[model samples]
Structure formats: C-alpha cells, structure tokens
Target chain A: MAEPCTRWDAEGRLATERGETLDAHFAACPDCLAARAADAALSARLVETGARWQPPGDWEARVFARIAREAPARRFSWWYALFPALAAAGLAVFFFAPRGGGGPGSPDPSGAGFEVQIGVVDGAQVVRSENPKPGDTLRLTARVPTRDPARVAIRIYRDDRTLIFACGGGEVPCSLADDAVRAEVLMTAPGAYRSIILTGAGPLPAPAGTLDADAAAARAAGASVTLGEAVRVW
Target chain B: MTPTEDNPTTPPRASSDPGAAEQAVLALLERDDRRGALTALMRLYGDAIYRHCYGTLLDADLAADVHQTVFVEAWRDLPRFSGRSSFKTWLFAIARHRCLDALKIGRRRRSRFTTDDDAPEPADPARDAETDLAARSMLPPLENCLGGLRAESRTAVLLRFQESMSYEDMGKLTGELAGSLQARVARAMPVLRKCLEAAGVSL
Candidate 1:
C-alpha cells in the first residue's frame, strides 16, 4: 500500500480544509490517480446504464405538435365562454353604474347585496388581488345576501381584452365553497390588466359579436354587475 | 459522429455543456420567436430530459410520456419562468416532481411499503432487480453499489457527476438547501468507496 496521504486519509476521509493541497497531491500521486479514474468510470457507468432506457428519438417534435394542436383550441375555448359576458358587462356598465353596487345587506337598487373581495394567493395567506403580477392565482370570492350560490363572472382587460375567467356563466359551473360563489383563475398570460366582476342569479346570454343592445338587454335582466380593476405587471 | 443541428432525431453520443444552447433558447424567447425557441429547447435538452426521466422512473414508456408532457408544459410555463434559475433547473424540477408522482402511484399499488435504510429500492420487478441492474450496467459491481445507495443519495450523486449540476442548482431543483446537499454528497462518497471494497473491486 502507498504511504498515508497528508490531505485525504487512509480511511478515505476527505480533508474539509486545504482543498488546493489535496488537489495538488492528488494530481501527482499514482494511487490517487487510480482512485480518480475509478470514480470517473463509476460516473460513466451510471450514465451508460441510464442510456439503456432513453425515450423515443422524436419526442421533442411530438411535444411541439401537441402544443401546436392545443394552443389555439385553448384560447378559442376560453373565448367561446367569454363573448356573452363581454356583452353582459358592457351593458351592465351603463345600467349598474347609475344604480351603484350593494354594500353588505343594504337595500340597494341592483339587488346585489354580496360582498366581493378579490385577492391573489401569496404563499400561505391571501392578499388583495389588485395590481397582480403575471403568474398569480387570482381568487375572486363573492358572498351573496343568502346562500343561493351567487354567479360570479370576472373579466380582466388591458386595451380590449387580456383575461376572462368566470364561474356560473354558460357551461362553467359555479364553485359553491364556504356558502359563497367563488372563482379562482391562474393568470399565466402576461400583458393583462383591469378586472370586472359580474354577479347574477341566472345565465347571461349574448348573440356574441353583436351591438350594444346585448348590454341593454342584460340591464333588463335581474343581474347585477360589479367592476373592479387589476393592473398586471408583465 | 458529429450531430447536425437541423435534424436532431438522434441524441449526441456524449453529453455536452448546455450553457450556450440555453443562451440561444433565451435569445429566441427575447425575440419572441417561440417556434425557434421550441426548436432550440428540444435540441438542447431533449436527450438530457429523457435520460433523467428514465433514470428516475426506470420505465422507458413512462419516461417517454413524462418527457413529452414536460416539454408541452414547458411551452406553457417558459414564458413566466422568471429567470430566477437556469432553464435546466426549472426543467429538472418539473421532471423530479413527475417521477416522484409516478413512484407514489406505484408505491400505493404495491401496498404503501416504506423504504427503510439499506433496503434496496424496488426497480419495479420484485424478483430480478439485481439482474436488471447488472444487465443495464457496463460495470455491474459499481452499478450494484450505486443501486444500494438511498434514493436521494443516488439522485444527488447522479446530478453531481452525470448531469454536471452544481450543488446550488441541485438544491434549486430538489428544494433542498445547498449545504445539506453538500453534506449529502460528501456523506455518499465514503459509502461508495466502502461498497466497492466490499465487492472486492479495487479503487
């Protein structure tokens, strides 16, 4: 056996200090060279063993094609659900802006006695959902005067549109958690700003791509619309 | 053989430093050339990710599925990646979680057996695990020694040597602190050394 090395011991313990000294000694020592070669071989073997189970050669192309197929459909699906609400909110803006929103259980003209507080999830606790950064989960909660499950629709816009996520609208079912109608949307897309919440008892329908009449028609319906704003940082 | 960039259907024979390739992907992202970014990303990381998934799950079919899923999800999440960590770290974070999730499902199916210290981690086949390890390895003794390590220790060692990850990057990928990771690898070396000795292999 070679004489004991000063840096790393005979027991194969590495010195915590004098790293350069060990490196210097290891470079010149034949036995140390052998040990390093063995370690290197071990690493190479691990890699070679892992290579036995490699995935298909065209995996990247397959994933790209899958993404291409899904991207437009995802946006279209969201848009298909959103067009009616856009009209509902547009008309609700004119009608509800004059009457104003309900506060707590007060007898307001809009009949929307629900308390709505929108917040972004910040780790453990939830904070107000205004001025959200991109990649935030926006939790929009609305408590109605009674436990009848309020229909909450939230749309956020920058210029024309940025995000539109609504529950209890069209085919989207209302999330009835804590006896309140709640909708949690994960905002992944960047460049989205401003948010509007619409609360109603029933479905808000629109012909979609129609005129301002849809909004006026929404006013005639018993629904109440509440508008909030979110300035999203890209 | 030198692999051409235009058609990378086959992986390179040797692993490469991904730094320049990662930079290229980032540049494409900056120019908003998502198609180019996708191409660059796949060419750069595709093989590494496949190997990673296969290494963790030890199932070729499952590894392919997860590999595809990671890239598809990467397309969605890459925009908001925030640049806080290297792209590989982000990608491997996704792979690690996917593999562990698969293992959890497998474990549940096998009656929720807890892995004790020194108990060989199951390589799926209950009877021929040793045979499987040996057959896959160029050095059967070294492979057996590696397989004998705890799952986390094995992962740590592989990421350090095979994947060429710094302890800090490994920490970011695995959500463990870097010092603990250092201690872990340091602790693992002696075990590996002792193991080879027990197997009558010269170090």
Candidate 2:
C-alpha cells in the first residue's frame, strides 16, 4: 500500500502554488479534505477572535502624549544649541548692520569669523540632534574664509578613548573653499561621542586615541582651530 | 502565564482606505508631527498590535506594556522610516521583537524563581459558567490551544491566520526564508487541529 500525504506535505504543496486550489487531491483524499477544513476553521476562528481584541480607552491619547513628551527632548537638544548662535547672528545684524551701512565687507559682524554647523540627515531632512541610537548618520557643514587655506577633518570618539571615525588624513583632507564644506559621519555605537572639528592651515592629521590625544596631535600640527561637541547616544 | 481578562474599549472606526491612512501617517511624520502621526497609527493598528502582543505573551499587562514600547520606539525611529517596507509590516515587526524580548525577560524571571511547588498547574474546572462564557466570548477555545504551542509556532500561526500575512511578507518581517516560514506554518497547523479536535471544536 502507498503512504498517504501528511497534512504538512499537502499544505506545503498548496502554499507553494499561491492559493491555487488542490481540488483533485482533496476530492480523492478524505483525510486531506478534513485537514484542510480543520485548518480553515482554525484560521477563521483566530481572525474572528483577534478582531474583537480592543485597545485601552485612552490608548491613542496616552501614546501620542507620551511620545510627544519623550521624543522632542532628545530631538531638540541640538536645536537648542543652534538657537543661541542664530539669536546672536540676529543681534549682530540688529546692533551693528546700521552702523556699517549694510555693506558686504562689514567686518563679518557675526564676529565668529567662521561658521560650523553639524546635524544628522535622516531621510529627506537634516536633523539637528544625533539620535543617540547607533547607525545614525551625522552631517557637518562648515564655511571658511576664502583667504585661509583651511583643511577640515572630523573625528568622532567614544567616551573610553575608542576612535569611532576619522576623516581628512594627509591623502584626502576635507578642503574648505569659500563655500560650505560638507561631510557625513555614520555613527556605529551607542555611547558618549565627542566629535572634534579641526580647521587647519594644511591637511589635518588623522585623529588617534581619545579626544584629548587627538586634540594634542592637532595642536602639534600648528595653527589649527579645533571645536569639540558632545553627542550622547542611547 | 496567567491570562488577563479582556477589558474592551471603544471599537475601532472602520476605514475603507488603508492607503489614505498610510499617506496621512507618513505626511504627519514627514512634517515632524510625531504626535499626529502616532495618533493616526494608533487609530489604524493599535488594536491589531495589542492582539498580537496579547496572543504572543498571553498576559494583558505585559502586552499593553510592549504595545506602548512599540509606539514609543516607532516615534523615536520615525525619521529613519525610509518606506522600503509598508508601515503596517514595520510596526508589526517591532511589536514582534518587543514581545519576544518580554518573553525572554519572563523566562529569566521564571527560571530564577522556579521551585518544586512551582510545577505547572492544571486548568481549573471549578470556574463558574459566567467566567467561562466571558472567556469564550473574548477568545475562541483555539486560543487556549495556541497557548500550548511553542512561542515561535504560535506566532507563525497567528501571523498567517489572524494577520492574513503572506509567507513572503512574514519571511521579510522575521528575517526567515519564505519556505521556512511556510514549513513552520505547515507544522503548526496539525498541532492546532489536534488541540482543537481534542477540545471538541467542530473542524
């Protein structure tokens, strides 16, 4: 006597056919038909019962409110830092522009002499904060004066002296023209990240070890302005 | 696991347009309206997520906790949602992972506290008819059978039937091959059928 096909075997075959009916097999095999019927009944019952499960009374309100409260704090911290710079720029324009007749070469009234802004690009938008989660990509934009042959490098370091990323070694420095210099850093680990941006007279040396060590090395390279910002990753 | 009694809230509003709902969610999230997007998402998939968590964990409180965690994580990661997968699949994947994590924590707690007296207890037959009726009304007898299967098997069954997910979608969401998921569902069906038959369920 030949062995009958098990339910698993029959179902596997049916699944491969993408819902094509196995009428001929079902017609010949009572056991398979019964099994199919049982499976259908079970599926129907599950869907029916599951459809009846309800969320809490204020589930939408609670979730929306909780996320609203928790999400913005982490997202807006970088923006809060940017706000001061923006306000100072506005103040400089308000306080000094009239005195200088709004001329193009009015001593660069913002007074910082250079502009460096760092954010993370998520989807279509460039977000201010590096979402403490691993795998976030950070975007850095800097505007340097045309006269200075400033070379740019970004170094990201974890709290324990482990180097996360370094760019603009001797071979490939992130050279800044009069326009904005843009670079991206992909965050790989979750911890405290200290990202140092170095604008040097020549090619910035690659970062080594901790932020302090990197800072010391850049200082040795002579006539470099280094800016450090702390990023916390969850 | 002790099953918690169901406390039904208002029934979900039926929407004829899932695409519109998805668009509305993405639009809000894209505009940085996290609250609005989450509110739309909750309206659309909250009950389904709760059911998935409850079915997998078999504990209402834990399910609710995982449900909240899912939304919170979704809101946090909403910016990175690149639309490679549908929002529904993405949300369910998150729900599945949170439930698995909760189950791991539960197992750890159970293992640490296990004693001779902590052996599995038989079902109580002395319960009143009203309680039984309530349980039956809330969940079919087949759910009790589902509770007997391993977590992976039960999840596969639920995702196949309750969620109406294709093997391909389930494979993508779970990072398993489609054939493997099909085999899992195939293996799970017999156990479910046998349990249902033993429970005197008609086919």
Best-matching candidate per DockQ: 1
Could you tell me how far off, in angstroms, the CA of residue B21 lies in candidate 1 after the best superposition? Answer: 2.7
User: What's each prediction's clash count?
Assistant: 2, 2
lDDT of 2 by residue, A4-86 (tens): 66753456344633665555666667666666666777778888878776667766556656766876576454532322343
Model 1 chain B scores worst on lDDT over the 10 consecutive residues at: B115-124
Which residue pairs show collisions in model 1?
A91-A215, A119-A129
* Cα lDDT tens digits for candidate 2, B1-203: 10011212222232678777787778777777665666567778888889889889776777888898888877766776767677888788778767866774564344334342222211122332333344444555677777767788889888888887888988866767877887787777778788788888886
Query: TM-score for every candidate vs. truth?
Result: 0.52, 0.55
Residue B14 deviation, candidate 1, in Å? 11
Reference contacts reproduced by model 2: 0.38
lDDT assessment of candidate 2 = 0.61
Give the best candidate by lDDT: 2
Off by over 4 Å in 1: A1-20, A23-37, A47-53, A68-73, A76-234, B1-19, B112-145, B193-203
Pairs clashing within candidate 2: A132-A233, A132-A234
